[model samples]
Target chain A: AQSVTQLDSQVPVFEEAPVELRCNYSSSVSVYLFWYVQYPNQGLQLLLKYLSGSTLVKGINGFEAEFNKSQTSFHLRKPSVHISDTAEYFCAVTLSISSGSARQLTFGSGTQLTVLP
Target chain B: DVKVTQSSRYLVKRTGEKVFLECVQDMDHENMFWYRQDPGLGLRLIYFSYDVKMKEKGDIPEGYSVSREKKERFSLILESASTNQTSMYLCASSRGTSGAKRNEQFFGPGTRLTVL
Candidate 1:
């Protein structure tokens, strides 16, 4: 079994400032990492994913993440943020189901990103 | 564009009432999943189906059941809805892969179920 840990429960940042949400995971085998964002009342949408190659992974909304194998971390970052970027972010790891028949995603608690004006 | 649609955006039911949450995907995906999102718990998978008539239990499947009669539709069933079951229910689907590295999951808007 695998698990994800999102360190920050809430992060408040001013508009046009930079931010980073930390995430760590524990797994024995190789894993795929993902970041998803959720608005006030909507379902989650994929932000970015780190499957293989190029440790730096770029995603939508001017966001990016770096996968660190040794540290077991996939931290999401944004050079600058906007008011519209306020949302709940999640980090997830893919768990192989039934030995390659299907895959299940195990998600972290989540971090509420608040972009202040 | 991949689109996953749920039957309802909001649902309210009484205790002991049978509740059904329906989800449909237009992209002809091979796998569908049902999950519940809580305040602290990110998303707990209840059940998932790889193909028609095939279902697998996820992490949290105690009070939940699922049905996948057709390829495009998956329904989560609660035989007796309880207040504890009140949460945001999200449905997602992805292309089933045997040896692929990753399968991006497309999620629906979600149904906010309030069990009274």
Candidate 2:
């Protein structure tokens, strides 16, 4: 079984400031990591994912995340945030190469990022 | 662009009413999923379908059911609406192919259902 923990429930940042959202996971086997962002009244959109190789993975909207194996962490980072970046972010994990129903992702509670102008 | 769409953006219903939430995808993907999002709890999978007429129960499927009569459409059914079931329902679709892309789900705008 895999479980994800997004340490912060809410984070407020000034526009154009750098920010990082922390995420950690516990899994017995190799896992895939993902970050999703949901704007107000909208569904989730993939921000990025870490499947294999290269610990640092870049995503859309100038966002990036670093997967640390020893730390069991995958933290999302953005050099500079915009007001449009205000949204709820989620961290998810799934077993690598697993098939069928086992492919379901286990998601963290979530982190609401508020970008203050 | 891959597109996933839901039938409603918002819905209100009284308790005990049978509710239906519809979802459709234009990507012709073989996998469809239904999930509910709530404050603090994030998203919980209710059900999923990998093929037409084939369904699988997810982590939180106690009060929900699903139907996938066609490749591009999937439906979530609430047999008896309850206040606890009021939530933002999201639908997603993905390819059945191997590799990471298969798990990269494209989500709909979501349907906020309120059960009174």
Candidate 3:
């Protein structure tokens, strides 16, 4: 089974400031990592994912994430944030085929990102 | 673009009453999931169906049941609504691939259910 853990519960940053949301996962076998963003009163949208090859993955809305195998982390980063960036972010992981079942995903508690003007 | 649609945007139900949440996916995705989102809890899977009539229990499926009578539709049923069951429910659909690559899931706007 794969589990995801997001270190930060809330992150408040000023406009145009860079921010990083930390995520860690635990899985005995290989796993796929993903980041999702949810706006107020809305459903989740896929930001990016890490499957294979490149460790650095760029996503929509000027956001990016790096998959670090050794640390078992997939951290999301943004060089500049705007007021619209204020939202809740979640990190998720799913077991690879070599492990067991790949149907369901294990999600983190979530990190609330607030961009102050 | 794939579009996942939920039946209700907001619902108010009384305790002990039966509640049903409906979801439909336009794309012919093989997998559909129901999840609940609460404050600080993020999203917890309630149930999932890989195919019609094939259902699986997810992380939190205690007071919930699911039915998939058709390939494009999935339903989540709350046998007895409780205060704790009041939350935002989201529906998502995804296409299944054989490899380890994660498939993008299209989500509905979500239904906010309140148990009174």
In terms of DockQ, which candidate is strongest?
Answer: 2
lDDT of each: 0.92, 0.93, 0.90
lDDT of 1 by residue, B1-116 (tens): 88999999999999999999999999899889999999988999999998999999999899999999999999999999999999999999998556443367989999999999
Each candidate's fnat, listed in order, reads: 0.67, 0.70, 0.58
**Residue lDDT tens for model 3, A1-117:** 678889999999999999999999999988888999999988899999898899999999999999999999999999999999999999998876642248688889999999999
Clashing pairs in 3: none
Q: Give per-residue lDDT, candidate 1, residue A76.
A: 99
Q: What is the TM-score of chain A alone in each candidate?
A: 0.95, 0.97, 0.96
Clashing residue pairs in candidate 2 (N, C-alpha, C atoms within 3 angstroms)? none
CAPRI grade, predicted model 1: medium
Cα shift from native, residue A90, model 1 (Å): 0.6
Number of residue pairs clashing in candidate 1, backbone atoms closer than 3 angstroms, sequence gap of 3 or more or interchain: 0
Q: What is the lDDT of residue A66 in candidate 3?
A: 98
Candidate 1: residue pairs that collide: none
Please give the lDDT score for candidate 3: 0.90
- lDDT digits (tens) for residues A13-98 of candidate 2: 99999999999999988999999999998889999999999999999999999999999999999999999999999999988865
